[model samples]
Target chain A: MSELWFYILAGMTVAAATGVVMLPNPVHSALSLVATLFLVAIHYASLDAHLVAALQIIVYAGAIMVLFLFVIMLLNLQTDPDESPMNATAAIAAGAALAIAAVLGRVFYAFGTSGAGAELPEGFGTTKALARVLFREHTVAFELTSLLLLVAVVGAVVLAQRDKHDARVEPVEPVEPVETEGQG
Target chain B: MMEPLATPAHYLVLSAIIFCIGALGMVVRRNLIVMFMSVELMLNAANLAFIALANRLGNMDGQTIVFFVMTVAAAEAAIGLAVILALFRNKPTVQADEIGLLKW
Candidate 1:
């Protein structure tokens, strides 16, 4: 029952993932990416990784994607002319990508795609189980990740700040205004 | 409903498919934001492979690492967008091929 669904969901995910890349309009690509991320969350759930799956949806489909949309809005980006599918660069890139995929496929085939996966252990992928390992074994790394996030936030703010004098166009001079009767 | 049970390989192949799409996007796309989106796709593909391999080995380590990957991805996305924003302000363009001053 689940296996068939896996194919269906995976198909949707792949198609949408490709759409995210191929769509000319960034907004449309973003919509497609959200669909892909949602399907990926479902795939995680199917693997019995409920916690990771939830995080996948919350962080990816929810937060990060919203951030992406916000940035897109901030930029007010125009359509890229370089997205032509028939360009020589695109053709070359496609050929190169195909070669890379073929090599990866050969490697995966060498490993054999048959029934080698082990059974899930008791309570694996549960929050409690995952927390135990995360807090106990990987605590240092986890704390470091928090620090990295802080740095990223500060860096983003600093980088995005533009000096008052710096304008995309010439700054209009401040005008001395006549005092309004109420204010006067 | 009852065909041969899906194995790790099935998941692995799916991950590969996503990864390939990501690689194609990164390779061909000109917009910096879209390129970053491709990077996200690749990261998710990595996460999928990690989950499948962890299931295969019956290990918690791989899953734990996925948490770390997500954190890093969030941070990367924030910083990357900021950088892109700065670049756009400077040049009014986000085409990866156009920003070649840093290139050799």
Candidate 2:
């Protein structure tokens, strides 16, 4: 039962991920990415990662995707007409990606026996179990992660903040390249 | 015989496939936002692997690591999107090739 759902979700995930890549329209791509993330969250649940699954939906599919969509709408980005599907870069990237997939697939398949059928502890992937490890043994790293988030928030605000002097500074007289080229 | 259950190997292989797909998207797409989405895809793939391994090993360490990873991914998205916004402000374009002011 779970195995069947896993295969189904995996197929959907791959399809949605493909949409995120191949869709010409930025909005469409973003929507597809949201779909892919949600599907991945389901995969997390099937793995018994309840806490991570919740975070996957709330943090990833919720907040992060919202940020992406806000950026897309803010920029008013449209479909890229110049990028056709059958380009040299696309072909090369496809080949490279296939190679990487093949290598990784082989390596993971080879890791089949060791730790294959080990029984999970009760509440193995629960928030309580994760929190115990996170707050006890990895406490310093956990605290450092909080600091990192604080810094990132501050940095993002600073980087995206509109310059106050831009109104005065931006309207400079246009310099024609023709005269400059002639002088050079 | 086909395994009746989904093993850690299945999840790990799926993770690899997804990660590769993300890499492909990152390379093939010129739009910075789409590339950023691809990066998120890759991160999610890694998280999937972490969860699968944690479950298989009967340990909480893997899940703990995934928690940290999620935090870091959130931070990365915030900062990266801000940088994208800053770039778009000056250039009015999202295509990566269009913004080459620093490429001497």
Candidate 3:
């Protein structure tokens, strides 16, 4: 029964992922990618990474995908007629990617399921276990990640903001506020 | 030969397949946003592999690595989208080939 679920989910995931790559419109691609992310979350659950699965749904499918759709709508993009999505160069890239996939598949198939599905430790895949490992063993890296997020926020704001003093437009001078009450 | 059941190797192979698809998307698509989505796909593939390995090894570290990868991915999305928006503002084209600001 579970194997059936895995096969079904895998098929759906590949189809949706293909949609993300093949769809012409960005909106369609974004939606397809959302579906792919959700299916991947199911795969995570099957792997017994329940906490990660929840985070995958919340973070990837929820926040990130919403942001993507929001940007797609904001941009009001239309499919470009001038540029074809696939070209001779793309064909070459596809060939390279296929070669890589073939090599990886062969290597992994040979690697086999020797040590997989081993006896998991207590509280494995739980939030507690994840947190203990994150905070106790890798606390420094955790703090650094927070710092990275902070920098990203600041950098995004800086990059996205319009230039106040553009070469084309003169900078607007700050006007002093009149004290209406005092004048009265 | 007996039909093989789903194993850790199966999951790993799936990850590799997805990663390849993402790479193909990255190069085949001309749209910057679509390319960015491809990058996300690649990240998710890596995350899936991490979970599979963590489960296989019975180690929490792999899961921990995935958590950090998610955080970094979030940051990358924020920064990358901002850069894209900025570039669009300068030259209203999302097609990667059309943007030739650096072309001499």
On a 0 to 100 scale, what is the lDDT of residue A4 in model 2?
85
Fraction of the real A/B interface contacts present in each candidate?
0.56, 0.77, 0.71
C-alpha positional error of residue A109 in candidate 2 after TM-score superposition, expressed in Å: 1.7
Any runs in candidate 1 off by more than 4 Å, and if so which?
A: A109-116, A164-184, B1-5, B102-104
In the predicted model 2, the residue pairs found to clash are none
Best by DockQ: 3
Pairs of residues at least 3 apart in sequence or in different chains that clash in candidate 3: none
Q: Assess the local accuracy of residue A141 in candidate 3 as a C-alpha lDDT between 0 and 100.
A: 100
- Give each prediction's DockQ, rounded to 2 decimals: 0.51, 0.51, 0.53
lDDT digits (tens) for residues A1-184 of candidate 2: 8778778888999899889889999899889999998988887787788888899899988999999999999999888788675798799989999999999988976775464467777767777888888888999998899899999999999899897587545455345665688899
Candidate 3, B38-89: lDDT as tens digits: 9999999989888878777779898899999999999999999999889989
TM-score of chain B of each: 0.90, 0.93, 0.93
The 10-residue segment of model 3 chain A with minimum total lDDT is A168-177
Give candidate 3 regions above 4 Å deviation.
A112-117, A166-172, A175-184, B1-5
Model 1 TM-score relative to the real fold = 0.87
- Mark the 10 consecutive residues where model 2 chain B has the least summed lDDT: B1-10
Tens-digit lDDT track for model 1 on B1-104? 11223666777777877888899999888888999999999999999888877777778888899999999999899899989988888888888878998889
